[model samples]
Target: MPALTDKQKRFVAEYLVDLNATQAAIRAGYSAKTAEQQASRLLRNVQVRAAVEQGQQKTAAKLEVTKERIVEELAKIGFSNMLDYMRAGHDGDPYLDFSELTRDQAAALSEVTVEDFKDGRGEDARDVRRVKFKLHDKKGALVDLAKMLGFMVEKHEVTGKDGGPIQTETRTWREVLRQEKKG
Candidate 1:
């Protein structure tokens, strides 16, 4: 393969940041007026394409990211039942046992927060601790999983004003008037 120029290499690196070609071209010092065209032209080059692919592979390798792994993580979130984390404490009060989180549950966890509140006077004070768990959107994860597994398809139907089937080949008043005039 032919060696890429310094600007081309920079463009490859910038493109990976957000996968925006025009922005990458502009950042790579291409003329702003022609950045879009330059981006398209550069992207079409075989050498540039190979470089981008190589860069992506290297990055994915470094990050240990893979399609199967991503889907498996999403599946974990999609199938995770909150019941698994809920357990009764020694006092029989229902509470989440953080230690019981599975690999998928751990992956699905987005945020965890603990808050403490004190009530009553100094002579009789009560300390209340609240633990909050913010998990990933299971519905969204399920949707993504369905799409990845080819179980989901975008359903678009042409409907009339009242959701009935669209009546095609129906001419408008203008067409009727024009036909009358032609006749």
Candidate 2:
């Protein structure tokens, strides 16, 4: 067998990562059916093993350089630290007030029983109410009411000036009532 070039050695190492001879062979540029035989032959050669190891080391070094460059570029773009990136990417509902809770209130909140709390007045205490409505598409066919109204209204769990997640359960509409009156 001839000595493999640097590019050929790198391809072989990538294929060997999963230890599937057929896959390794195909990835190293052999036809799918020939991959198994080619990979087996390559693996058995001492020179090929040495070359593959060298290729893998070079690939790893290149990957490290690429990762460092990406981090450096991100820092230049105002993401000075990894924590800032993580906070911007994943943190949700930044305005929730956890500071006002008493010990019992916090315990109750932990149990998820806040949904049952009601005012002493005669009116319904639920923050959200579900209402169904019909909508028509451009072709005058009835579209899903929930989807249509969903676009118009936003949902919230804890209510303040700032919005939260949409309350899918408790919703109402005056427009649907008006349409009913006209029909």
Candidate 3:
């Protein structure tokens, strides 16, 4: 393959920014009306594809974005239970001890609020303080992990007019998690 011209190299670099070929072409100085066509032509060029691949490899190496790290982070958020952050005291009231939070639990924290106030008169005054914390997006993380583990399957059932199920499907998220833990 022949070498890429300066603008073509720039287009390849921009393309990796978001994997949007038309936008990359526009950013690389192509006309708005013809950016899409230009991007298609550029993608068909073997040299341009090779340049994009090389740039992607370099970017991945520089950022250290590995699949293992991504899965580990997703698992941390997906498996985290809100109950893990709360403890029941002898009084039977659940209270959160921020100091007792683990690394992943802390990472899962999305919001924290502290309110301290005095209640009643001076003679019967008591300190009333509340600490509230919201964790990261649990459902989103769970869905992402399920997809990564090949568990987010769309099970369609062929039904008669009465809507009776004619087919069944199953996903093994639990089994995959168990295997990961054992291994």
Candidate 4:
């Protein structure tokens, strides 16, 4: 196969930074007006695509990141249960209990707060301990996992007024120019 051009190499490097093709093309010195089209075309080129994949593989190796690892982390947050981090007290009130919290369970925690205060004044005073813990967004993590696994496909439908199909008009450039000259 043909080697990538210098500009294409630059594009592959820039694309790896954030994987935004249009921005990568622009940064690689492609014309801003045509960067989006250029990026699409470049990505379709066999040599460029190979280079980009090779670059990604190298980066993944360096960072020790893999698709399975990412999915596992997302699953940790998606499948985590609140009961894993708390338990029912003698009075039947739920209280935070991390005595048996596992590493996987801890991964799902977003925040934890502990407060100690007096519930009442003087002789009637009682010490109260409050523990609040927030879990990472379970729905968001599940949605991400579903998308990554090809189980969820997001669709956007564009329509005209009243939810009907969009209306479009097609005209040739020559006809448009002639109409403009007449007006």
Error of 4 at 96 (Å): 1.1
How well is each residue in 131-151 modelled by candidate 4, as lDDT tens digits?
888999999999999999999
Model 3, 59-143: lDDT tens digits are: 8889997777888898888788988888899999999877778898887888999999998997899999989988889899989
Q: Rate the local accuracy (lDDT) of all candidates.
A: 0.90, 0.50, 0.88, 0.94
Per TM-score, the best of the predicted structures is 1
Can you write out model 2's per-residue Cα lDDT over 1-183, one digit (the tens) per residue?
678776457556766587566777777677776577667777787887777667667877867755445333332332122232122324562223334444422321212212334455567554543222221122211122223434335555585346665445443568756765787
* Residue 61, candidate 3: alpha-carbon lDDT: 84
**For this target, which candidate reaches the highest lDDT against the unseen true structure?**
4
Candidate 3, clashing residue pairs? none
Q: Residue-wise lDDT of candidate 1 within 78-120, one digit each (tens)?
A: 9887777789878998998878566767887888899999988
Roughly what TM-score does model 3 have, to 2 decimal places?
A: 0.68
Superposition error at 44 for model 2 (Å): 2.1
In angstroms, give how far residue 34 of model 2 lies from its true place. Answer: 3.4
TM, every model: 0.70, 0.29, 0.68, 0.69
Q: Point out where model 3 deviates above 4 Å.
A: 18-20, 40-46, 117-127, 153-183
Give residue 179's lDDT in candidate 2 (0 to 100): 62
